[model samples]
Target: MEKYLMKSKAMHYVFVIIGTILMAVSINLVYEPLGMVTGGITGLAIVIKELTGFIIKGGIPLWVTNIILNIPLIICAVYILGKKLLLHTLFATLCLSAALALVPSVNILPEDYLLAAVFGGALGGVGLGMIFVASASTGGTDLLAMLIHRFKPYYSIPRILIVIDGFVVAVGAMVFGISKTLYAIIAVYITTKVSDGILEGLKFAKMAYVISDSYDEIAKAIMEKLERGVTGVYAKGMYSDKDKKMLFCVVSKKEIVDLTELVSEIDPKAFIIVSDVREVMGEGFIEYKQ
Candidate 1:
């Protein structure tokens, strides 16, 4: 048991290391060269590095700037987010900083700042996703998001975070240009989307809950037309005080309309409910793996 636990932790650390390095490469190769600040402490670090380049010759390195900014946030996280998260956050931060130092800045794009923004944001998003899935974060504005989440649990941290990151990106607009600013916005949007996709996984499906008097007909129609399995859950109507077959089926979004039509044709007032399912693994969908 102890050996297994150790192995798990080791794998997690490896993943975080890889993720941080990929993120650093994206920053150095894409963001820095294009001067596209897509938000986050890393973005700010780039801005600072450029602004202070005259003072210290080459300027304060991104790794140093990143660590300096993350210090207070890390401390705040330890108090608010707990020690486990803080430990992982610290590891992620350190790994990211080391990566930034090791990975040299290279110009991948010639004149296409748009390409840089897109690629940089996508690569960074993937790295961030891997870190997040491992229960760690590349500390920066992430700490601020967590801090805000702690204060107001009701408000969505990610959405609020967009507003926060917007300011940072706006600063980039001022320093960089209107064109770069637009690309930065695009980068940030794509980054969030790709990160969300990674965190949620790729499995997408729809769930339909149907309560109808002609349960047998509806079930048969769904099986024949939709070619999907239907699970009949025994349920009782509240007002009617009568037992019935509450059918349930998981189908693709494309098939939803067909299934709904079948249900409606059978019984218009069937008390049907449909909902979006983010992930599903079963006989019909992605195979269960362990």
Candidate 2:
């Protein structure tokens, strides 16, 4: 058990390292170069980096700004949230700052903000997703949200994040102009969708509900032909004044067509409703591992 725990921690740190690198790559190569601020501490860093160009030759380096800004936040996080809870987050934040310093700033997409937005968003999303899976964060706006939520329990963390990040984006618009900021918004949206997709799990499936008088026959056909399980839900129809069993089944995306055809064949008048299932676990799906 000790060995397993050690291995898990090791893997988690590895995830944090890799995730920070990817995030740094997106920032330096895409967002920073294009003046597209997607929001967060890094986004604020980019804005500052641009604004300070008048004072400094190339403006303050992103890593410098990132680390300097985070120092106080880290100190507060330790005091407020405690050291134990912040160990992983501190590691992640330092990793991100180090990555920003080490990774070269090369604009791969040059003036093409569209490609920059999409690609940068996807890369950052996947990276952030991996970090989240490891139960860690890069400790920028996320940490700020936690800290705010700590004091004002009424305001949720997510709402705080939106307000904070939105403020950063708005500042970016003023600095970088509307056209680039619009692209930034697109990147933000894509990043959100992709990260959400990663957190929710990639194994997509379909859930189906069938309402028909011949539900028993349909259920039997599904089990035998599709090799899937089915459950009968007790449902009553107010219009028809009838009590019947509604067939509930979950099947892979590929099998949904087969299930639909089988149900239609069994009962042409069957009412079928199909919806997307983001992830499925248990028998014939994602298994639990220690």
TM-score of 1: 0.80
Global lDDT scores for all candidate models: 0.84, 0.85
Candidate 2 local lDDT, 139-183, one digit each (tens): 888788778878997874445665688888999999999999999
Question: Highest TM-score: which candidate?
Answer: 2
After best superposition, candidate 1 residue 80: deviation in angstroms?
Answer: 1.1
**lDDT score, residue 198, model 2?**
68
In order of appearance, the predictions have TM-scores of: 0.80, 0.90
lDDT of 2 at 234: 100
* Candidate 1, superposed: residue stretches over 4 Å from native: 1-7, 151-157, 209-214, 221-229, 232-246, 252-274, 281-290
For model 2, give the 10-residue run with minimal summed lDDT. Answer: 1-10
lDDT (10s digit) by residue, model 1, range 1-290: 11222247777798789889889988999988788888889999989988999999878899999999999889878978899998889999999999999999888886687788788888988887677667678889866876787788775444555677899999998888888889888888877777766666656789999988899999999999889999999988889999888999999888899999989998998888999998777878766554
